[model samples]
Target: MKAGREELMEIIDLWGYSEDAQARIREILESEDVPPPHLFRYYGDRPGKVEQAERLFERTIGTPHALAVNSGTSALMAAIAAAGIGPGDEVLVPGYTFFASASVVVASRAIPVIVEVDETLNMDPEDMARRITPQTRAAVIVHMKGNPADMDPLMRVAADHDLTVIEDVAQACGGSYHGKRLGTIGDFGCFSFDFYKIAQSGEGGFVATADDYLYMRAQSWHDTAACWRPDRYAEERREGELFCGENYRMSEMQGAVALAQIRKLDGYIGALRANKKRIRDQIEERDGLALRRQPDPEGDASTSLVMFADSRELAEEMMAAMRERGVGVGGRFDQTVRDWHVYSYWEHILEQKTVTDEGCPFTCPYYEGQLPDYGPEMCPNTLDLLSRSMHMGISDTWSPEECDRIAEAINSAVSEVLG
Candidate 1:
């Protein structure tokens, strides 16, 4: 005999809210024998799960267009490809972001000029504008660790420089700035639904834009074989303007999970904010200790709480004391494993390590602008800010009492160490 609906609901309940994602997968498995969206039978004539996901995500993001891709890295690559940025072009990237942000520029055969970050740990508009040259084409503004970058100034600079703005919202999926969402403010918004992001589809991403022409280019880039065409078998393959590209299309399985996870994004961000506020509100602020400033506190994703010490030694001491008290804080710099978030540790770009011997992008004759002098200490401001910072992540699943305990532990650490 088959289990009843109530029994299935109960089973889903045992797994908690995230079970919706699992239930979605199970629902698809039980009802349909459908293969991936790109399968011959499942063409683009009718919307598949991936298409549905794109629509759902578009509505959630309030963007005019959104194309679901395989990964966040692919989303960045697709955005660059769509913009037609190539060798000799320079894309300004922050010094504190994931290496992929800069590496994507190199992948496009373009130069990635590293910009210094201030105390905010996001890109500095001043540094960005200072780095621009004749060949500068674009800027990848990263929303680091679920915090939106200061977009108003950055956008102004981009406008003045005629640079394409690609907002990397991988860490700030549900986050917003002022009244607008993080991804909607820029020329193109990229998001990651990886295992560690606010929303998770295991490994999935989306490229968003308000431009129709660029949307078509992004679509073509994600599925160059024409599988994403309005009619899969159309006689003119390029839709008159599209061209041959790569395959970064999201499958039905990933879409199913992505839809479910996104459905819970608001709740996730809400709980995270509430939990973070509870702990933060109780902490006392005084001399030699300051919380990271948020331009729009209400819109912040609130994934991690950062405390800046007056000195690196004090920061290290605070982290050690906090850890001993079970507050669970860690320092920002880690040279041993070489944290990918820190720009100084990136040996690939600093050393100009290309895939082949010829060093096409680095040595390409098309690059007319003078190459930048990269080094471990290129961005001293980035290293200085990171050195005196202690990071502690806030959990959406924490209880009110748990938040109180954390606050108490933090207070204790500050008194013993910073005092």
Candidate 2:
């Protein structure tokens, strides 16, 4: 018997494995001599599956260095450490992004200054500029939902402030910005290959950079102060001598899966982009409904289809209408729905303290006087725009019939709301 719609919806891991990916995993499992070489990434190391995956990642992202780590959050943490962001340092992050964008700053012993987002759901460069204080050291530009942020102006702002920019391309694996790949455009580009991301590795991520010093710094963080190149090794070899580091290394098994996934990434991104464009072209200009304004020099990886309505009321109406037709429409303001990606939905970030007891990051005796409190009022624009936004998932696996049904549902929902 065929499965019910509700029953099918319960199965969340839609990340189907490619035949190539399956074969690679099988080989790893079946081989007797498949022992990982230099799993710790020591110098003069023989290249294994992990190193091979790193090389492929570097070539794919057009970066000089790529260090695979345990998770996207680990990639961000390593990037933070590489940039030398520490106590009293402030990193600007969009208030509309995933929790890791802000939490990673905390983990780095730095403060995350929440900044407002524009209609594009990306960090507003103007607001980011306004939030800058003497303590501001870096900015993390998230390419939310595989849509590239406007890097031109954002880069200019960061340059003016002498702030290091890190591109959070977790959702934008195969995406680019103005012909340049998303992650390579910044000081450090971080990517996630978690099961849900564009490139699935079960659980994995990497940091990409063009600077040798930063690459070495990241390597230290990835393997507990172990040097990537032998020359950087400390003569005394004291703990935390080169720098305070942690264990965030990716395993050879994970690397094998990621290497296979990388080969199929471009085709998947291309298909999803085409499907998104087809749907957007059909419904974007309809009255009371429109696609969110994509940044100039847009790179559509088509991770999800986001639509904004004239107001919150219209957005809610359209959401209900779409759901009745079997389309799972997600709204930014729906707090009860726990999985919404909007920052307002992440109460943990606002409620929890960055550092326990001492308030080492926020209240640490580093910056000028007292730090400004982070709360809802800090990003009014983000709060407002998100109230009227809704989105639906897009995937390479979607069939033409599925696309048609979605388009029809969107059209009908708009008509129902307008009528």
Best by lDDT: 1
TM-scores, in order shown?
Answer: 0.89, 0.86
- Candidate 2 overall Cα lDDT vs. reference? 0.80
- Give, for candidate 2, the lowest lDDT window spanning 10 residues: 4-13
The candidate that wins on TM-score is: 1
Provide the lowest-lDDT 10-residue window in model 1. 33-42
Full-model lDDT for every candidate:
0.86, 0.80
Residue 202, candidate 1: how far off, in angstroms? Answer: 1.3
Q: For residue 306, what is the lDDT in candidate 2?
A: 86
**Candidate 1 TM-score, C-alpha based:** 0.89
